[model samples]
Target chain A: MIRAQKIGKSFGPLRALSDVNFEISQGELIALLGANGAGKTTLIRILAALTRPSTGTAEVAGYELNREQQQVRKRIGVVSHQTLLYGEMSAQENLYFYGRMFRVPDLQSRIDELLGLMELKKRRHDLVRTFSRGMQQRLSLARAVLHQPNVLLLDEPFTGLDIHAEELLTRFIEKAVADQVTVLMTVHDLDYARDHAQRLLVLHKGRLAIDAAAAQTTRAQIVELIRE
Target chain B: MNSLQQIYTILHKDILLELRSKDIITTMLIFSLTVVVIFNFVFEPGSEEMATSAPGILWVAFAFASNLGLSRSFAREQENSNMQGLLLCPVDRSAVFTAKVAGNVLFIFLVELITLPVMVLFFDLHIGPVWLPLLGTLILGTLGFATVGTVFSAISANTRSREVMLPIMLFPVTVPIILAAIKSTSYLLAGRDMSQVWSWLRLLIAFDVIYFVVCFLLYEYVVEE
Candidate 1:
């Protein structure tokens, strides 16, 4: 579902990714492991069709990233630190707005299902500014998946969550994975990655350092690979 | 869905958000009134000078006040990177510019609806038969304001000091609109026949068309990440 062949990105003298090569099949849940400046977000941005690689080509869901950006964007969903939702808008309004933006078929029913799924039904009418951080984060996830995208790109999805909220997000992402939504997530929580992700891809200094099946790898081994 | 439907979806969200907060309208309305009252102090009542300068002062107040509203509306989108969200939609990015232009046009029109009577009363202008032509001038002028304002607003929204960048880039480009609107308005306020102002009205329409199409076409590059 995701392919990056020799993808390289540079900003001035700094290289964010160098000759990165990888392919993620449909339903493959990947926990992208890396340090800061390791190009996880850069790679995610490229695959999400938000940024272009300087030297190589990439594709998402059969659409080339550079040429078919709109098509690629329609197939992929992204969740980042910012929720990408209007604070003054209600959760329901936010979803409805995205529903129409994505032209999701049967939009109202899908919105209702998402509200219930995210446990935001009771508070759907309240402005997002009044929502707690955890609630806002949950709504962000809900907005990402609202379009029913084929690919999910998550950058630090587990940050700023209380135990309960984290667990809720964990369950949501797991379900998305089980349903064959291609998932590539950048996460710092190695234990969480080991437990949830089927494969571990590590990056260091804008280069791919390791790629291994999660079940065959230990937390120490992954950490050692990243440190190297 | 076609781009119009996407444009409508964005326009609806912007209007809905503005309705709930009323921040942009309130800010614009109050700012306009303040500009008018301050100008009221600068010149004595009913002097030939004030009478001649009133249209210029009024359009200046409007141009500046509408900038405040345009900035605020985009500031709302900038809050959560919602502009980025809008860009990621699978439609042509020009829809973003059109929808925002429509929203700002509505807000600027509402502000003018309040400001016009206040302008008339405050400036002691005679509005007999020229009201229709006067309203036409206002709509065309506001279209220009909302048009160029929407373009520069998108441009500055990406900068570090948007409030500083907007006026710097916006003011010079809109000289023709301000000049045309002020001249036509001056003619209207002087109780001149509408036919006498046809040249200026044509100029305003021409400026509106040129800017609207150029801004629409150039918008994709401005807002691209």
Candidate 2:
């Protein structure tokens, strides 16, 4: 589970996130909804242990976010719009590299499984630079989950993906939640988020404006809420 | 696995990539040789005065060639947001810095290895039994250069004019390493006694230790998103 209490972040005179508080329980797929510059990325970075919040505390997987950052990092998997794969390396090599970093046992078979699951088996040996955007996104997903992290954070994961790729990603997210992994992602596509996420949290001008179970929320309501 | 092992894996990957493409090595070699050839023509060889200046010429070639290689070290990562991929790994950011320093050290050493033979041939200067000291100087000097260079290269990699910004930022900070390295190399090449050369060697070693530790500590700040 991930919990943030009064999390706030600022840059000089500009405030990014202020007094933001939320909790993500195990097996919950939470979609973070915010327009550009609405603090989704900042909040995610703080939660991912990549950036320190200006105030408040975050606890993830029973570890205090600020005090036990390493532990928090170890429990989390992340994928952003930037597919963090090395362009010169093959998809398998990139997975192998990350697996080695995370100290995953039986790394080769783990990589193979991820490649097969991502439908990248035939292209596993090809350099990431040669792969199309959708292919790279799929591989990026594989890289993030290489260690089987319990908590996953994805920023704009579906960007630039085709319908087929989007379907694959949706399936991946569903399986992740089925396996009891806590998933949090930011999205602009309300329809996709509406169908996929178990909960929706909206951010407006760096403050939480709406938090509700997905089943209770309506697309029109979310659209109107964000538009405000 | 430990942090060192992770660093080793990354370093090994970089080295293997370089070996396969030979891109960095070839450019460094050609550039270093061109600088050496130009120096040879500008200064008459085998003259007593020329021997005194050879050490400076050799180091100038190395510093420039090293900068060339350092700039390219992060080029692959800069392209297509690969750096973000590397950063997303849960590994300590310092490991990234260390791996880059090690890779740059290896490339610089390889370039030195190629440049050394050519320096000897072009300058007609016999290095004598000072090979050990020369080798020590090369390794230590390269360590200092790579330690600081890796940090600044990473900094410049994020900037708009990375190609122009790297040298401007790197050269000024690295003046101490270049100076100490050139001084020590000159003393060693001249067959000076160990006692006389000890101070400059100490300076090089000191610079290497300080920068290596400082850079390791400060890396997390530079890499933080």
Q: Best by DockQ, which number?
A: 1
Please report the candidate that would top TM-score against the real structure: 2
Candidates in order: C-alpha RMSD to true structure:
2.2, 1.9
lDDT of 1 by residue, A117-157 (tens): 88889999999999888898999998899888999999998
lDDT per residue as tens, model 2, B145-205:
8888888888888889888898899889888999999999889888888987889999999
Instruction: Give the TM-scores of the predictions, in the order they appear.
Output: 0.93, 0.95
Q: What DockQ results do all the predictions give, each relative to the true complex?
A: 0.65, 0.54
Error of 1 at B217 (Å): 2.6
Write down the TM-score of model 1's second chain.
0.95
Residue B73 Cα positional deviation in candidate 1, in Å, after optimal superposition = 1.3
Find the candidate with the highest lDDT and give its number. Answer: 1
Off by over 4 Å in 1: A11-14, A215-228, B193-196
